[model samples]
Target: MNRRMAVPEQPLLRVRNVSKIYGRSCGECMEGTGPERESNICPKCGSIVAGGPISFDVYPGEILCIVGESGSGKSTLIKSLYFDDTFSSGEVYLQNYEEGKTNLLALSSQKKRRVRNCLMGMVYQNPQLGLRLDFTSGGNNAEKLLTADWHHVGKIRERAQELLARTEIPIERMDDCPKNFSGGMQQRVQISKALANNPSLLLLDEVTTGLDVSVQARVLDLIRQIQRTLGITMIVVCHDFSVIRMLTNRTLVMKNGRVVEAGLTDQILEDPQHEYSQILINSML
Candidate 1:
C-alpha cells in the first residue's frame, strides 16, 4: 500500500497591531446657551480616539471570517491588509516566493502594487465598483491581460467563460454588460474577474450584503465551494453569523472596533466567553 505524505501548512498571511484613524474631528461648539456639542472623542472615553489594531493569521487553504457590525473595523482591517489605506501602526507579513515571510507594510508602493494583483484577489462590497460597468463581462475579465504577460485574448476569453460557468452564470451572458444583469449576477461576474488572477489568497468584504436573502445563501454556498475547489486561503468580512458558520471553521468577533473573541466557530457560537460576544449572540436570537 502506498502512503500519501502529509502536507505542511505555511502561514500565508499574518497581521499584527494594524490600525487606521480618520483625521476628522468634531468642530467647536456653538453658543454656550445651547447644549455642549457632542465631542467626537473616543466613545470609550474622552481620550483621543486611537483607531483599533487587528491581529490574526490566515493559514493555507483556510477560511477566516472577520465578523462585526458596521464601523466595527471589519472593512478597515481588510483595506489595510490590502494596502488600500495607510496603516498607522503594525505589520503585515506575507509568504514570499523565496519561502520566507515578508512584511507587506515594509514594501514600497510599486512592490505593493505588484504583490496586490498577483498574490492576492479582493472582492469589494460593490461588484460594479470593482469592474468597468461600460465594458462587457468578457471584456472586463480580459482587461487584466493588459497588465500581465498573457496578452492572448483567446485564452482570457476561455478562462473567463470557465470562471463564469464556475459561478453558475451562463457563458452566453459573456457579451452582456454588468449593468444589464441583476445584482446577484453582477456579483458573480465580479467573482469571475477576481479569479482571473488565480491568486493564492482572496479577500472578500461583505460581498453578499446587498443581495436578497435567497441570493445571499446562493452566493455564500458558491464561495464555500470555490474555496474548497481552488484551495485558496480566504479572509471574509461579514456581519451575518449564518454565512460565517456555513463557510468558516474559525471566526473573529469584533465590537466597537476591537476584537472581543477569537476561536473555533462552534466554540465562539456555543460558549462565547466575552461580554460583547455574549450580547451579540443573545441579540442574534
Candidate 2:
C-alpha cells in the first residue's frame, strides 16, 4: 500500500513500532498479532493494543495528516506520541536528540516536562485540555510562557498580547476569561496558548470538529496562516479528508491502529491504493 514514498533523510520525528496495549503483554501482543486487524484485543493476554506497531516519519516543516474513522485507533496513536498516554512498547525519537540512542519513554518526569513544553505543542479537540478556562486569556497564554521558564512579567504580558492578536483575538479581551468566549474563540485562545512557546512541533487532533461550519473555516484559515508564518511542523488527525486536503503535505491512513497507506496527500486522495484507504476516500467523495 504505497510503501515507497520518499522521506527526508533527516526527519524531525520518528516513531518506530510505537505500541500501546491496555492489558498485560504477551507474545501475540508484542508482535502485534492482529489476525483481523479490527481486533486489537489479544486472546493470549486479553490486552487491547490501542495503537501500533505503527511507524512513520514527520519531516521538518511538513504537515502530516492521520485519518481514520471511529475506533480506528488514530486518536490513541497521537495521544501516545504526545505522552498523554504511553506506549506499551516501541521507541519515539526526536531528531537531533536521538538515534534510537535515547528512548523518550525512559526520560525522567522533569525531562519529559521539558520536552513537552519546549519541544512540542498540542491542540486538543476539546479546548479545555489545552486551555485554562478559569484564567484570563492573557493568563492562559502566560502560563505556557512560564512553563518554558520565562520570568519577565512585562515581557510575558507583551508576548501574550502578540500571540492573542495573531490568533485573531482582540487585544482588549485579553483580561476576559476563556469560559466567556464562544466555542471558536476559545479554540483560538487555545491555539495562541499552544504557540506561546514557539514549539518545533504542533499536534492538532480533530481541531475543526464541533465548530459551526463558518467558524471551522476561519480556524482552518488561521491554522494555515500560522503554518506559513511560523513554518512549524504539524501532525493533524481528523476523520474529515477536507481538513487534510487543506493542511497536509503527507498523510498516513490508519485502520485498527496500523498505517494502511502513506504517500503525498494529493496522490493518496486521488488514487488510494489500499483497500481500506480506497473505501475511506470514496466515502469522503
Count clashes in each candidate, considering only residues at least 3 apart in sequence or on different chains: 0, 0
Off by over 4 Å in 1: 1-9, 24-40, 43-51
> Least lDDT summed over 10 consecutive residues: which range in candidate 2?
1-10
- Candidate 1 weakest ten by summed lDDT: 28-37
The sequence of per-residue lDDT tens digits that candidate 1 reaches over residues 83-198 is 77777668888876345466778888988887887777788899866788889988888875454445777888888888889988898988999989998988888887778888
- Which pairs of residues clash in candidate 2, taking residues 3 or more apart in a chain or in different chains? none
Model 2 Cα shift for residue 77 (angstroms): 1.4
Off by over 4 Å in 2: 1-8, 30-35, 96-101
Error of 1 at 162 (Å): 1.3
TM-score of each: 0.86, 0.93
Cα distance off (Å), candidate 1, residue 205: 1.0
